[model samples]
Structure formats: C-alpha cells, structure tokens
Target: MNIPKQRIKISLAMVMPALVSLSILMTMSIMFYIQYKNEKRSLYNNTMSLNLSSAQKMAVTIEALFSGMRQSLRASANNPAIEASAASDQKELQVIFDLMLQSSPYFNSVFWADQAGTIRVVSPVGNNLNQDRLKTEGTTEALQERKSYISAPYRTPAGRWIVLASEPIFDSSGKYHGMIGGTIYLEENNILHRIFGSGAGNGKESYSYIVDSGGRLLYHLDKSRVGENVSSNVVVKRLMGGESGMQRVMNTHGDDYLAGYASVTMNGWGIVMQTSVSSILADVDRNLEEQLRSMLFPIVLMLVIAAYTAARIAAPFTRLYKLTKSVAAGQTVSSEEFRPHWNREADQLNHIMRAAAESLAKQTLSLQQEAVTDPLTGLSNRRELERCLDSWEALRDPYAVLMLDIDHFKSVNDTYGHQTGDQVLKLVAAVMSDDVPKGAVCSRFGGEEFVILLRKHSMDEAYRLAERIRNAILISKTPYLLPLTVSIGVSLYPEHGRSREDVFQAADMALYRAKNEGRNRTIAGVKSA
Candidate 1:
C-alpha cells in the first residue's frame, strides 16, 4: 500500500503549531486548578475560625447572664425582710419571693428549707404554698457545706426540669439556721431562647443547652431535650467533669455538629452550645461555588478565544489549499480567477490579482464598445440609443430633449462620400460635448442625432446651452474641407411631454418643421395644446 506524500507533508506541518498551543493550554489549566484548590482550602479555614469565635461569644453571653442571676439572688438572701420572713410566717416569706419575681424575669421560684430537712416552697406565683415537703437531699447536703451551691438539674413533682440555687442562712451567733433557695425552670426562661434563637442555623439544626455534672441535658432551646442523657459523646464526658472542651460530633439524631462546652464557675453545671456544620459553613460553601465558577469562566473564555484564533489563522491557508487542489484536479481556470490568500504574503498576491482583473476588464470593455457604435458616423447604434433614452427617462429630474439632423446630410454623404458625413457627425458631437455645463451628460442617440440631460437646470438654461452649441456648429469648418450646418430642434420638459416618448415626438416634430421651414436653422417646439 502506497501512502500519499501530500497527506504526510500536511500532517507534519500542522503538528508543531498544535503541540505548542496544547502545551500552553495544559500548563494554564494546571495552574488554574492549583489556584482553585488553594482558594477553597483558605476559605474552609476562615469559616472554621469564624464559627469558633461565634461559639465563644455565645458562651460568654450565657456566663454573664448566670453570673448576674447569682449576684441578684445573693443580695436578696441577705435582705432583712427575706431573712425575717424565712424565720417567721410563711405568708410573709411568700410576699418577699413574689416581690423578687416581680422585680426580674429571671427568678422562677423562691423557697426556704429548715435544718430538719423540711421544705416550704413559694412557687413562682405570689400566694402558692406547698408546705413541709421533703427537702431535696442534694440541697440539704449543699447547704450543710456552709457555702452557696448550684445543684444539678432534677425533675420536680410537676415533671419540669429545674436548676436549684441554694445559700445557707446564718444567725448572729454564727449558727446555720436553714437555707434560702431559688428554683429556676431553665426551659421557661428567656436566656436559652435569646442565645439559640439568634444563633446561626436553621430552626431544627442548631441549639444551645445547659448540661449537668451527670452529663444530662438540663435545659435546651428545643425543650424536648430536658433530662436527656448525653454522656456518650466524648466532649460531653469531658464537660461533665467541669472541664471546658469543644469537638465535632454526631449527636444521637445522627446530625454532624460543632459543640462548644464551658463550665460555670464554682457551679457543677456546664453549658454546651452546638451548631450544625452545614449551618456554620454555609457561607463558605456558597462562596467556594462562586469562586469555582469565576475560575472556570476565564478558562472557558480562554478556550473559546484560542479556538477562534486557531480557526482564523488556518482559514486563509485552507482556502488556498482548496484552490490548489482544484487546479491539480484539472478544473477549468478562467481569467477571473479565485481570490488570493490573505496572510503575510497577501500584499504581493493582491497587487498581482488587481493587475490581472484590470487587464481583463479593459479587454471586455473594448469589445462591448465596438459592438454598440456605428462605424460610419462613430455614433451610438440605434439599439444603444434606445437603451440610453430609456435609462434617462427613468431618472426623477426635469430635462430637455433635442434632435439634430445635418441639413442636406444625405446629399453630402451621396456627393462627398461617407467620409465627410462621418466628419460632420464627429464635429457635431465635439461641439455639443464642449458647450454643455459641467454636470450635464451628453450621449449619441443615433447617427445624426444626440441627446443631453441637464441635471437640476432650468428649461431656459438648457435652451441657452443648446443655442450656443448650434451657433458653435454653424460657424465651425469641418476637416473634410467642406462647410456644413446642422438643423436643431428643442423641446422643454412637461411642456412638451410628461414621458420620454412624448418628448422625442415633440423634438422630431420640431426637426421636421426646421427642414420644412428651411435648412441650416434652429427651431423650438410649441407646447402641446
């Protein structure tokens, strides 16, 4: 099998350009990929740092609220009214608790417990009483320690989970008399709602909650998590031991979350704030997607431009190749040949193409001129006269038509030979051509006949130009060595006829009148009635 040499040669020539373009394109793509990866990594790190800072801020807010509550309760416990009420009538104690509750939204309930483990509860309501119930064992032990204590969360008889704040009361003798305590229903208070409600996640996906030393959820924004055990999580276990910790974990519900925990000072409870990873990193994800699109946009645009450049650079060569192939295949090549290639070599090729086209056009025009001219008079043939008249009439301007005949032209052609007749016609054409205005067009209508189109000129101007040509002709001596004169007939536009045929008839009638009235004279046609 013989392989084609032309195919091999073309393939080799194209290889270098393609390889250079491909190498540059691949390098750019790799660089862009690396840049995109680095951008995504940086965004991820920034998102993580921002989420951590937000969690820390929430922790600080919760700590501040709890600290304020502790201080307020401590102040209330030291009040003389509160101290006296705890020792005397329970009704008076209820009044003091009611007053404290009214003073702040933070207080849930206040109660007094005596050293005998008997408890009198002043519910959140001002007059509610549940007297002499069993004192919470945790509260009893906590008061015996002779210092203020915040007990772990526990469920009350009403099935509500609450946190207990207890402070031991002492007399002037320095003896512990009993304890003054406040019960806070953490879920009912607004602290959790404020923190978690304003937190950065969709409703079901994020939460803030308080946990006890037992790793049980004491209060959550969702309310349903109260008393739920969370000790299984490693972060929860560390937090339960009163150490602050943070980690990413899957909760019992199988949702990924970023959990931040911090223990309350001198209180056995910890606050754990959890935010879903999806919520915390949502902005980063959206930004990454936009960045990726931005990066890809340039790549796509570059590829399009490269493709266009390649196509543009190759188009001229492709056309040249096709033309060469046509010649090689023995196709007929005319004088009007295919256009030359447009490239670095275009200047030389364009000069050659222009010269060839001009030479061919001159040859074609000479042949056409010979066919349209009368040999005897060197004037337009009858066919060319009609074509010129038709073209002039189609124009949208007012003009005059004239017809001239040599007086005794046939007699001169008969006696002095056709050579003198030709001379007379040439002399007439010269006189008419020279005397016409700059923009007027004169054409040989036929042998012994001519037409003039004066653009935008008045009928008077046209007649004046015609009279000048007639006078010039009347005084002229032809090179034929014989004196000659022409009879002229003139007709004005619209006054003679609205159409070219009518104008021609009017001019002819004036010419007939000149011949009838006598020879060697000019005559103007009267307007048609």
Candidate 2:
C-alpha cells in the first residue's frame, strides 16, 4: 500500500498534539484541585465568622432585654398601691398596672395578688384575674419569701409562652402582704426584636431564639418550637448551665449550625444566635466559582501553547519515518529530498523539540508541586492527606492523624467581615504549620478544619502536639477579631483502625466529641484492640 506524505503529516499533527495535550490536561487538573482547596477554605472561614458574630450580637441583645424587664419589675414593686394591697387600693393598682403594661411593650399582663392568693386587680383583665396563685411557684416564692425574682418560662392556658417577674408587696410595717407581678408573652412580643434590633440575619437561614434554664424555648423565629424541650442539645445544655460562648453544633433536628449563646443574669435564660452552615458559606462558594472562571483563560492559553509546540516537534519525525519506510522498500533517498531540505528541517525540529520539552518539563514540575498544596496557606490539602494515607496503609507504617477544628471561627466573619476572617484563617494556618513536629504533615482540610499526619509518633506524642496547637490557637489574637481556639481529635493508624478511612472516621468522631464536650481542647479516639 502506498503511503501519502500529506496523510502522514495530518496524522502526526492530530495525534502528537492530542498526546501532548492529554498530559498537560492531567497537570491542569491538579492545579484546579489546588485552586479549589484554597477557595473553599476562604469561603468556609468567611461564612463561619459571619454566623458567629451574628450569634454573639444577638446574645448581648437578649441579656439586655431580660435586664430591662427586671428593672421595670423593681420599679413597679415600689408603687404605693401595690405596696398597700388594700381593697380600696384596687382602683389605683389597676391604673398603675395598666400604665406598666402600656409602657413595657413586652408585658402581656400585670396583676397584684394578695398574701391569701387572691388576685385583687389585673390590667388588661384576663381569666387569671381573681384566680388563686397557691400552685404557682413564682407568686408563692415572692409573697412568702419577701423577695423579687423571675420565673421559668411556661405556656399559659391559651398556649402562649410567658415568663413572670414578681416582687414582694410590703405594708408600712414591712410585713409581706402580697406580690406585684408582670408577664412577658414571648411569641407575641415585638419588644424583643425592637431591643435586639431585628433578629433576622443576612438570609432566611439565620435566626435567634430564647430558652430558659430548663431548655424550653421561650421565643423563636419558628413559633412551632416554642414550649418544646431542647435540653438534649449540647449548646442549650451549656447555656442553661450559665455558660456563655460559641461553637458549631448539630441540633436535635439534625441541622448543623454555628451557634452563639449567652445566659441572661436575671433568670438564667439563654439567648441562642444561630445560622445554617450551608447558608453561611454560600457567598464564599460563589466567590470561588468566579475565581475558577478567572483562571480559565490562562489554562486555555497553556493548552494552546502545548498543542502548537507538539505539532512542530511531530512534523519532522513524521517526514523522517516516511523516508525511512520508503528506503527500506528499495527506494532511493537524497539529502535534498524535501522542498525545505532535510538538514534545515532537522535543525528546526531539534530547536522546537527542545523548547517544547523545556516548557512541558516546567509545567510538570509546577503541577507536581501544586497537586498536594493549598495555595493560600502553603500547606498540604486533603489530596495530599489522601496520598499519604494510601502510602502509609500500603507500607503498614504507623502514624497518627489529628483533626483540628477552629472553635467559633464563624463569629470572626460576622463581627469583622470576611476580609478579616481571611486573615484569621491564614494566621491559624501559619500556627499549625509552625507548631507541628518536624516531618509531620500539616494540611488544611477545608474551612476551619485541618488535618495533621504525625509519622511514627506515639499516642502521647500526638496528644502533646495537638495540645500545643490548641494552646497556640487559644493565645493567638487577630486585630478586630476575638482570640482564637481549636479543638483537636487524634486517631492512631492501625491502632484506631486498620484502614485509612476507618482511622479518619475515628478521628472525626473524636473531634465531634471534643466539640460536644465544649471546645478548645483535644480528645483521643477510641482504638479497637
């Protein structure tokens, strides 16, 4: 069969460029992976910080609301009509209670109850007026104990949530006669939003709510949850115990949230500021997409360069092969066989091939470097961690994996904005990179989470490393942002589990436990025998 030179040239052009492009494409994929890791971390931090800050601000507003209610109750207790508690004083007491209800937007009702448990007067008179309060703890405590206090939130007969604040009434002889009380109808009260300055967030997924010491919701954007028990929730439990802080928690409804909580001093009630994890990170994800698009042009240009260079190198080889094949079949060949001449084409091919080889080599090196690298933090990414896991599992090399999550990182973005949040993440990344033992692999596993592989380290050594990182994070301060802290979960390979995935899961669970137990600490995974 006769072979046409044009056909050979055409095949060479198509095949060589394609082969070269394929290799370049594989390298480009790694670059894209690196880009993805960096973008995701930035986005995650921004979202988390935003949610955190929103929660904290909402917490402060809630404390102030409770404080104002307490102050109002105190002022009302000193009224002459309330202190007198006489039958003739009912008219004046009604006027005072009515004025109190009008002035306090949150007040649902106000009433004066005698020591005998008979309600003398009530403003905006309801079924409860003239009712006995012997069964009510709030009224009994104030009337008998001669003290001022706030009560746990409860649902009234009408199914509305209300909290009572009561102060003991005393006669001129300082004898406890009865009590003057005020009620706050949580769901109907617009006063909370007024004081908190609107409990809504940047999106529908963000919201705030109030819970008493028992974890029964007093107020919520979703009214259905009101009067429901949330005591099983980790954050709620902590807040009910009078602890105030922020963390990422998964609620009983199976929703993950960045929550900030604080306890109200007067009643031990909790203010919860929370937002969905997905909604908080949405803007960051969009930003990452735009970044990828911006990088597309450069990638296209590289592919073009690879193709053109491949074609030049392939042309001369195609011509040489054809000539050799013809000669082997007893055809004569001369030095000046082609229009361009063999020598001239040989020189041109050599130069083009060298240039193409150099370009390809440089790109290959770049890809290798970036394949496991997180660009923004200059650390290994999840891809690198996966690679190390595969190698360690195959070689049966013992190691420890530490999963570290930044505590309350979302609040940073909420308070200082995303730009400052980025700075906080970078600082944390730096700390992790610097603090780990030499030869350990430190990586950002996306967002405020990071992974570190400690080679041949004992469980004790791993714990120390984790503790150091945790402590460093706690002490680290970023401008315009709060101090940072990290929770670390440690799992040893072959000890925790035989497989990489098993070890990773074990570590993750331990990390979850650490966060659940209150953050800014380290916990070791349970290893199977």
Candidate 3:
C-alpha cells in the first residue's frame, strides 16, 4: 500500500521571507504602538476640548433663551390690560395669557398668581394648582421680592419638574398686584430639546444634561433621570462650584467619560456635555487601522522582494538540499548539516542556510502564536474566533455561540482600581477556561465581555454551559473579596443563524437582553427544536 506525502513544504526561501517580515513587523509594531498611544492621548485631549466647547455653547444658548423668557415675562407683567385687570378677572387675563403662550412657545405653561401665592389663571390648563399657594421654586420669590426671578428646578403640583421664570406684576404706580410665571417643563414641550436637542456630543453615546444648584437633574437625554440628583457626579460637582472646564470622569454608573460643564448664568444651573472614553478610543483604533492599511503595500512588497531575492540566492544550494531536507514548525535542521563540508565557501553557505532556515521556522511559529492568542487571557483572540467560525461554517458543522459579560464589572474597577479589575478579568477567564470543555473557543471579547463558541452544541447544551459558567463565577472568590456575577446569552448555529455575523449578533442581542433583564442568568436566543 502506498501512502500520500504531505503536499505543503517548508523550504529555505519560504522561511527567509517570514524571517524578514517578522523582524520588520516587530520594528513597525513597536513604533506604531508608541504612535498609537500618543494618538490616544491626543484624541482624549481633543474630545475634552470639543466637549467643553459644546457645553459652553449649550449654556450660552440657554442663557440667551432665559434672556428672551425674561423679556416676555416682563412685557406681560407691565402690560396695562393684564396688570390692571384684577387677578380675579379670568376673562381679561385669558386673552393676555393666550398671547403670551404664542410668543413664548418655549414655555410649557403661563400663569397669573396673586401676591398671596394663590394661582388665579393658568394657561395650557389641567396644570391648575390654582387652589394651593404657589409652591414651585421661583414663583413665590418673584411675588414676595416684587422682582423678576428664575427659580431652581422644582416639582409642580401636577408632578412635572420645571424651572419657573416669573416677573412681579406692578402697575405704573409701582403697587404690586401679582406675579407672572412662565413654566419650562423639564421633560415635555421640547424646550430642553429646542435648547439642547441638537445634542452636544457627536453620537448616541454622548449627551448633554442640566442640573440645578441643588444637584437635581432638570434635563437629561434620559427623561427617567430628569428628576434624579446628580450632585455626586464629578462634572456636576464642578458645575455647582461655578467651575467650568473639561475633565475625564467616571459617572455614577461606573462608566468613564470625557465631560465638559458650564453653569447657566441666569439661575446658577449647570449644563454638562459628555462622551464615553471607549467611544473616543474607537476613533483611535480606526486611525491605527488606516495607518496599517497604508503600510500594507510596503509590507507586501518587502515580503515579495525578500522571498524572490532569498530564493535566487539559494537556487544552487536548494538543488542539493531539496531531496533530503524539510523543516516542520517545531523541528530543526540537524547540526550535522552545519558541519564543515571542507570547501570553505560551499561549507559556509550551506551552514548559514541551514541555520537561517531553523531560525525562521521558529520565528514563523512565534508570530503565528502571538497573532492568534490573547496576551492577557491566553485564550483565542477575535481573529482566531473568526477563523474557526469560518472553517466550521464551511464544513456545515453545528456550534453554539455564548456571549458573557461580567455584571457591574465597571464597579469592580471603580472600587478596587484598574489593576484589581484586570485581576478579576483574568480570574473570570480562568473560570471560563476551567468550566468550558476543551476545544471550546473562549475569548475576552473586549472589556468585560467574553465569547465562547461551543462545538457541536445544541441550544439547551449551550445554555446549560452558560449557566454553569455563570454559577461558577458568582460562587467564585475574587482577588479582593468582591462578589461577581455574569450575564450570558446563548444562540445556536444553523438554527439561530447560518452566517457568522448573524449568529454573533443573535448572541449579542441576547447578552444585552440578559443584562437589561437584570443579569446573572442565561437567556437563550432564537430558540429551535
């Protein structure tokens, strides 16, 4: 019986190009790494500068808005028809209130309240807290002080949070009768949107928010947080102190951000704009990618030239060595091949070629290893994951995609510091490696996220595996006595999705769903029988 020999061969020329390429690659990577880091630092500085400018722009816009609001309130207050008409004269006041609403579309409501804080006529009705004294922040001051005032954020009896801009109503004789108040509803009427709706940040991850002097959020891109206190926020704290500038801060939710803040002059309210640090670094990665693409032609050209030149130089020697020689990844050329052949020039050439071949072979393996493995986690990297997925897809093999994220992992970093956070990541990686069977590809899928591709797994099997990992992590001890939990999303191949992108996306959506559904459990995506 005849057995077929392996077709692929590793030769002297084949090894030389990789050797040259590896050396060049090392030099370029180091230089590029330095440049990459510098670029990141530069990007951060630029983002902060832009954020500060955006915050200032929004603050100035709001100030101008208040100036206009004040003018409208003053005009309404001093108007003969409205000012002289008794607060009890609802018919006369209604005409003027309707006119004020048209001119000040930015205001949510308009009202006439007498000196006793009893609201008389309210425009945009249903907001009638008429029977009660004016308890909202700024209205009472304007009535008692007999001066124009802008209130801090306060909740209306209608349960709406707003800023009340009010002017005292006094006749030409300077006798105070009542106050005119215009309401800027925090969440509705698009007033905040009209001022900050264009948004200060570049993308969805970036947003602008407003906080009162007391730290209550008057406006935020997330309406749910509008009334929540953000005084503990670094940017908000600075804004409260009348300090305006840009800085890198970690928010209350343990996310790092580049933020800029300014206090609105009218009421000492702080306006802040912020973007995520990770988002800015993504830009840096794109720059690096562009840089790599530009370098690609030169790299390929060098490899081609090196391979041709090395082959041309070794032509005669190759004829002699071709039949008897081959070098596998870990195997080396016998030292006997390096012994003196007794012809000085021929001996030296042969010796050097053999040694060079061995060196390059080792280097080729080293570069391949480094390319596919994650340095920190020692697991397969993203490139490897993609490569394996492609191979499996081509073969029409079954697999399960599990995306796992460490819950509140940011808090681990914030509380114990980044070094400790790194330790937690490693430990989690270790747990994943130990729990998941061998040959399953587990990767640190950026930040606190991990991805596992389980070969030949059904949807149920994949979910069970995810639960095992989650339970192990929850019960596992941390480097600093911190308890950790994981959210896992499982999706199966061919059933959930036939393509790589589709499958990963299914798993990712499930992963986020698990997180959204309050974490520490597995959610199966795209279920199939």
The number of the candidate with the highest TM-score is 3
| Candidate numbers sorted by lDDT from highest down | 3, 2, 1
Q: Over 4 Å off in model 2, which ranges?
A: 1-12, 15-28, 81-89, 130-134, 193-197, 202-204, 280-284, 292-529
Model 1, 332-383: lDDT tens digits are 3453455654564433333443454455457667878878876654555666
For model 3, how does the per-residue alpha-carbon lDDT over 131-171 read when each residue is reduced to its tens digit?
67876556766677788788777776678777788888877
C-alpha lDDT score of every prediction, in listed order: 0.66, 0.74, 0.80
TM-score versus the correct structure, for each prediction: 0.49, 0.55, 0.56
Checking candidate 3 for backbone clashes, the offending pairs are none
Name the candidate, 2 or 3, with the larger TM-score value: 3
Residue 134 displacement in candidate 3 (angstroms): 2.8
Decreasing TM-score order of the candidates: 3, 2, 1
* Model 2, span 172-250: residue lDDT tens: 6887767777876677755664565464654347777778889998777776677789999999999878887777888
Instruction: Tell me which of candidates 1 and 2 scores higher on lDDT.
Output: 2
